[model samples]
Target: MLPWIFIGLALFFGVFWFSGNAANILIIYVIGLTGMGVFLVLTSLTISKQSNLLKKAFETEKNYPPLLVKAILLFAGIGMLFGSIRYWQDVPFYQDQNFSVISGKPSSIDEYNSKGTVTELYVEIKGHTFVLDADMPQFPKYKKYEELLDKHFTILYLPNSNWIIDYKVE
Candidate 1:
């Protein structure tokens, strides 16, 4: 029961992690789907072990349905297949097309909002943009970014997909 609850929570987290991340699906898909696959595998293993123990103790296989274990394993396999597809999608075929950082001047910062002084930053690496995740409670927008229009920053991105991996103030 508790495991099911955690799985639900993971699914919710995956949703938030995937928000505004369609172009940069690697972060959410790789971590979230892999976690889902691992959880499914664990469920399969635990169910099998429990069934085996029950069989040995009762001297009969009637205690638990054998199909239950097989079902869990089947779901695990399917989930892992989906995860593998996402994991392999961004794999680079060329050196220059891999992860690269573009260092240049930040042209502008728009749509600025602050919550009682806390600020959230959005990074536009290549063409993809996403909110910079940080300690939310202590969210701080750098003065250089807001005050100076020509602040220097480095954008880490994938050349082929033109997806922004990350960015940092320089």
Candidate 2:
């Protein structure tokens, strides 16, 4: 059950990563920290129980000492805490108010294809390169790439990840 919960949390976070919305990063960071705290509390409770349900469920022949379990949990918690702190540090850059804007005709437009499908799009304008991920809401359709050519565009983007948040073609 805990594994499933972790998997669900991972999937939830993954969706936000693929969304290409800078503002969502701070939300994910907060949720991730909360989830890690919950995980640590639950793990501590489970470890304290005499029967050790997790060990029984795994059906391990070797009876591991409680100290070992606690140590392992501690290490895991520390790793997760480190990750959360790192995410927190990046939150400011992902905020919507920090978005940078670029406006001009694209000096070059490139598409990276994989297995006969366009997977990533790169547009360069005024010496700055911006990426339009396929999962991004602002990602133009494949057919629209041609239309984008020869047009001036104004793009709002996250500088850290070079992700396009919003774009307007003129």
Top model number, lDDT: 2
What is the C-alpha lDDT profile of model 2 across 50-85, one tens digit per residue?
435556765654456554665575566556666666
Q: How close is candidate 2 to the true structure, as a TM-score?
A: 0.47
lDDT for position 139 in model 1:
33
Candidate achieving the largest TM-score = 2
Candidate 1 per-residue lDDT over residues 1-170, each given as its tens digit: 54455456556655644652554456555555555565555555445434665477567767355455547655864676575563455555222356766776544454446675434566454455545444433333555545533556676666544455666664
> What lDDT is obtained when candidate 2 is compared to the true structure?
0.63
- Residue 53, candidate 1: Cα error in Å is 28
Q: Report RMSD for candidate 1.
A: 10.0
lDDT of each: 0.54, 0.63
Candidate 1, residue 97: CA error in Å? 10
Model 2, residue 24: what's the lDDT? 37
Poorest 10 consecutive residues by lDDT, candidate 2: 16-25
